[model samples]
Target: MNRRKSREIAMKLLFEISINTNDVSETIENYKENNENFDDVDFAYVENILDGVAKNNEFLNKTIEGNLTNWKLSRISKVNMSILKIAVYEICFQEDIPSKVSANEAVNLAKKYSDDKSPSFINGVIGNIIKLK
Candidate 1:
């Protein structure tokens, strides 16, 4: 499974949802409409993660809040926040994918989308969550 591609889609969908509070299914449908050849494998990942995160948002936010040191989830950048949500979802909910993979992918997303410091900041937060777990 090309989880990185899936993770990328998950993050994109999650970020979009965070912004406008659109329906996940609708947003995904729109996403699919735009991106050609997104394929079933990738779409499944996007749908699963988008659904998973939405299903447990309150709990996931609380878990992320608990792991944050002197910082609230809202304080983080939207880009990093989106990445963190994906990572934390994988960490706290999805057991098929390892925590380390989630953490690494989050850092990569941060490096790709967020400011320079986001990678380390995200790494630290994810590391703390791993330690706590």
Candidate 2:
């Protein structure tokens, strides 16, 4: 599939991992086994995101927390947090992907999976992250 779709799946996987605290590779393997459309997805991209984000979660959280004006990382919804993690991972680690694109995709994911206010909130956080980067 396209990068957008790959990101969507990665976001979902991140959300699952955040909640379940499962082994990343095992979770991804199970997801692949269950998902019929797995063939279309860019597994390389997804795996990179999953492994990178998992490996660097503490740093990512600190970066996100530092960028926040008044909110704690715990205050953010899990779904929004997952979205932010993916975007942040892309911005910080994926040299091929533009920061703006990562931020935009994050806002799109928030709009789809989070509440109405989440899009703007995510946009603001990502904007701050881009500025800091």
State which candidate has the highest lDDT.
Answer: 2
Model 2 scores worst on lDDT over the 10 consecutive residues at 32-41
lDDT: worst 10-residue window of model 1: 36-45
Candidate 1, residues 43-91: lDDT per residue as tens digits? 7778888888889888877887888888987788877878988898899
Error of 1 at 1 (Å): 4.0
lDDT of 2 by residue, 1-133 (tens): 6899999999999899988998778888989888786667898899999999989999999999999988899999999999999999999999999999999999999989999999999999999999988
Q: What TM-score fits each model?
A: 0.93, 0.96
Off by over 4 Å in 1: 39-41
lDDT of 2: 0.92
Error of 1 at 52 (Å): 0.9
Pick by TM-score: which candidate is best? 2
lDDT of each: 0.86, 0.92
